[model samples]
Target chain A: MSITEIIIISLIKIVIVLGITLITVAYLVYFERKIAAWAQNRIGPNRVGWQGILQPFADVFKLLLKEDIVPERANRIVHAIAPMIALFVAFTTYAVIPIGPNVNIFGYDISLVVADVNMGVLYVLALTSLGVYAITFAGWSSGSKYSLLGGIRSSAQMISYEISMGFSIGGVLLLAESLRPIDIVNSQTNLWNAIVQPIGFITFVVSAFAETNRLPFDLPEAEPELVGGFHTEYSSMKFAGFFLAEYANMVIASAMIVTLYLGGWHLPFEQSLGLSGIWLTVAQIASFFVKMGAMLFFFIWVRWSIPRFRYDQLMNLGWKVMFPLSLINIIWVAAIIMIFN
Target chain B: MSQTSNSLKKRKKDLTFWQKIYIPEIAKGLALTFKNMVRPKFTMEYPEEKFIPPPSYRGRPVLVLEETGEERCVACGLCSRVCPALAIEVQAAETEREKERYPEKFEINMLRCIFCGLCEEVCPEEAIVMSKDYELAFTNREDAIYGKDKLLTPVSQLEDRIEFLRKYK
Candidate 1:
């Protein structure tokens, strides 16, 4: 492909991915509310549209019309930039996650992912670490006690959990022998990483929940204790920015979990079925989405069922339990490779 | 201090291997919620389906307008005297009808009315009864002070509440 062609293709891919991520994020909020209501045995929002399908649009309009309040004591520039940083980190991390194998499109070979860098896994970890800065900055810049405390809690929680998260990925890296996401997905063709190393799977998932600031680890945004937490002083579309970023991060987390552990787009015993070409590619892509959707549902399910962990309990779980378990997982994976290879 | 530490250890030891892990307990909770998710919801879907309160429900106090277009109230001032919140105000005036006195002006300040049904209970003529009109909203204090026109309901409409009051009171 020529320079211009490559540029055009990359631009098209970026638009498609961004559009999909945004729409999914919007509906994810709607589903979160609906599922929460269902858990409590009450009919959720059905007034906006049929079964409240248009509830997200209504929410967006409501947020857009609200007054954007900034505290007199706030650090204006940093407060303004915090949610932007959050949104940037959430969207950019989606670039390395491959949805399907390379397909010949109009006689040009095209990979499904936007960018297929060799160190994609490292890139993801680095970007997600940067996400903590967004919350911390928002908390500190808000000039409110609640926001500051939330920021402090978020940074501590994320930093602690990221250790176990990294070690859990270490087990996958040891097995795949490549930091590239596509290579990792390709490695788990027969037996998924989840089946081979259950301990790593469990730890990685728990860490993912903590990393995304979902419930059970949502101590930073604990309403009763910290009010609105890091976003306490935020209002209008700026607050919506944080809201969008949180859900977008969830999409990325579930996608990462699917790619690393559940064998990405590959289906078990697919070769024995003797499928070929476009049909096979389509099936594989569908499988990828199905797995990702199941993971998303599981995220929502666990949220409504489990209560938030106490701060001391959270720290203990991260350090005393999760960190050691992830290390043990790495050793276990190494033993498996030694026996098999 | 030793006893406290010992009790803590015993509490820690009480949890079996599975309970300590928490995965199974979490799963059990998840299953319970999932079952509830599929079960019938209890939402009333107000506006589409209005709730018909039983006769005993004390909603909003209203004056009964008899079929002959005269109010059942003879302006005896009993309800106004018994009102704990001082919500009811009635001024008696001479009338040519056999029920010689009528309220020239009767007003109930809904803002002050606690829905305690004291006015209804103290009515000598069964004049004021609580009706099933609970949807009361007003933008200003003046609008909240319901006059005679807003407070009056046809006697046919208030039969359920009046019947309940007769049987129980």
Candidate 2:
């Protein structure tokens, strides 16, 4: 392929990924409200448009119209850049995730993923780790004690959880014997990694929740304590950036979980269906999205179901429970590989 | 050798292996929420679909206007005095009707009214009863001080509450 062709294809892929992600992020917020209301047996946002379908757009408009207030004592540059960095990290991590296998369109082989890097998994982990800076910067720049505390807590929490997360991923890497996401997905042909390494899966899922700063693990932005957390001084579309980034991060996390553990895009016994090449590819892609949707639903469901963990409890779980558990998972995976192979 | 009584000791049992894992417990919680997701939602879509409060439901206090277009209040000053928040203001005037005294100017400052049901309970002539008018939105303070027009509800409308007060009170 020519350089122009490559650029065009890359541009197209980027647009497709970003477009889907933004739309999903918007609807995720809408569904989060709906699901929360359902759990509490109350009607959520239904007045905006046809059962509050346009609520996300309405929220964006409201945020855009609001006054962008920066605190007098705040570091204006850092405060402004924090959410942008978050948005960048959250969105960029999706570039390497293979939503579906390679497909041939118009006799040209087109990979569903944008950038199929050799170290795709590492890229995702590194980018997600960079997300810590966004929160920490927001906290420090806000010039509020609340924001600073939130930032500090998040940094500590993210660092603690990332250890378990990294170790958990170590098990998957052992099985796949590759750092690439596509290879990881391909390795889990019949039995998923989730079934094989249940402990690792559980630890990874828990750590993902913590990494995303979701409920139960959301000590950094514990609303009652931190009073809006790191984004206390943020207003207008800047705040919306963080909001968008958070939901986008959820989408990416769900996708990663799907790709890593849930057998991304490849349905069990799908090969025996005797379908055409195009149709099979389509089915696989659809399968990937379906799994992602389910994972996202689980995320929202768990959020509403479980109350936030205390700071001490969170630390204890990370260190005493998750860390040791993940380490044990590595041993378990090693044992299975040695015995079976 | 002192013998310790086992009966008086507090049992501090450790968590079992399964409980220590916590997955089963978390699964139980997830299942509970999942079940609730499909259950009959008790959401009353307000404004579009107004909630019909039960007969016992105490809403805004309203003056009962009989079919004769005359209020049931005889300006006894009982309801005004009984209002804990001092929300009611009644000025009695001489009338040609069988009830010689009638409230020429009756007002209830809903801002002050605590919806305590005291005025409804203390009504001597069954004049003032709480009606199912919970939507009390006012733009300003003056609008919130409900006058005779705003406070008065037809006897037909307040029938459920009046009957309920009679049955229970």
Candidate 3:
């Protein structure tokens, strides 16, 4: 394909992925509430449009109408840029994810991704780590002691969890023998990596929760302590941006889980389906979505079922538990591979 | 008998590597929460459904009356003197030549009443009692002020008083 045509195709994929991400983030909030209510034996938002499906939209409208207030002593530029950076980094991580195989679109074979970079896994890791910058900047720029403390806590929490997160991926790299996302899925043709590296999977899942700053690891945004945390001073669209970034990160984490462990875009028995043409691609895409949905549900399930961890407890669990477990898991995988190969 | 637990406490040491990870404990916590999720809820839908008041509940105050439509209160002024909230007021008047005291005006400011049933307890002739009529919301201050007729109970429930008055007369 010509360079111009490739660029156009990439643009289309970017638009589509962003659109999907936005819609999913909106509905994910609703899904979280419904699941939480069901867990707590209470009726959640059912007033808005047919079982509260439009409640998120109503919330968005309310947020938009609210006054955009920037504190007098706040660093104006940094305050404005923090949430945007967070949101941008979150949206960019989805570029490497393959929703489906190449398909004929208007007489051109168009790939179902924005970019198929060889170092997709490292790219995702790097972008996720950058998320801390947004929170840190937001806290520092707000000129408030509470925001600063929250930012510091968030950084500490994220850095500690990130070590395990990176180490957990080492197992996937060992099994797949490649850092490429598509290659990882291709390696799991016979068996999913989740079954083989169950411990690593668990570590990854826990680390993902911490990385996203979700409960029970959501101490940075603990309402009673830090109010609204780093974004406490934010208002209007700026505040909405932080919320969007959080849900978007959740979506990205779920997508990564599907890609790394559950075998992205690969059905259980692809050969048996035997249906050629676009049908296989369609089935693969559907399978990818199903895995992503299941992971998202698990995220919401854990959030509602558990209480937020205390700061000391959270730090202890990350450093004293998850870190050591991840290390052992990596060493075990390496030893097994050495013994077999 | 208490010394039995000291042995277990002394034996409890640092957690093993596996236990420190808390995978099993986390699983247990998850199980507990999941169990709670399925259990019956404790929520109460108000407005649409009213709660059944207990037998000991002290609701609104009402004055008893005879079947002949005579007031059981004899304008005694005892309920007024004993009321802690000073909610009761009575002005006595002479009836005919008998010098029998009857209230020219009687009122009970419900907003001021503490619902302690103190007046009911202090009534010598059981002339005033609390009834199960608690839906007494009022929009205006004046509306909450209960007059003699409104505070009086129905004659049907004062059958004994009606018969006693007939026999005594």
Note the DockQ of each predicted structure.
0.82, 0.68, 0.39
Best by DockQ: 1
The TM-score measured for candidate 1 stands at 0.95
Residue A72 shift from truth in candidate 2, angstroms: 1.6
Cα-lDDT of candidate 2: 0.92
Fnat per model, in the order shown:
0.85, 0.71, 0.47
Q: What is the TM-score of chain A in candidate 2?
A: 0.99
- Give the residue spans of candidate 3 off by over 4 A: A2-8, A273-277, A339-341, B1-19, B40-169
For residues A1-341, write the lDDT of model 3, one tens digit per residue: 89998888888888899999999999998888877877888767877999898999998999999999999889999999999999999899999987777789789987677888889999999999999999999999999877888899999999999999999999999988888887888888778878878888899999999999998988777888999788888899999999999999999999999888888888888998797988888888999999999999888888876789989888888898788888888887898788878
Candidate 2 runs further than 4 Å off: B1-12, B95-98, B149-152
Q: State the lDDT of candidate 1 residue by residue for B62-164, as single tens digits.
A: 9999998989889989989999899989999997778899999999999999999988888889999999989999998899999999988899999988889
* Segments in model 1 whose C-alpha atoms lie over 4 Å from true places: A272-275, B1-7
lDDT of 3 at B140: 95
Docking verdict class for candidate 1: high
Clash counts for the predictions, in order: 0, 0, 0
Task: Please give the lDDT score for candidate 3.
Answer: 0.85
What is the TM-score (0 to 1) of candidate 2?
0.92
lDDT of 2 by residue, B111-144 (tens): 9999999988988899999888788898899889
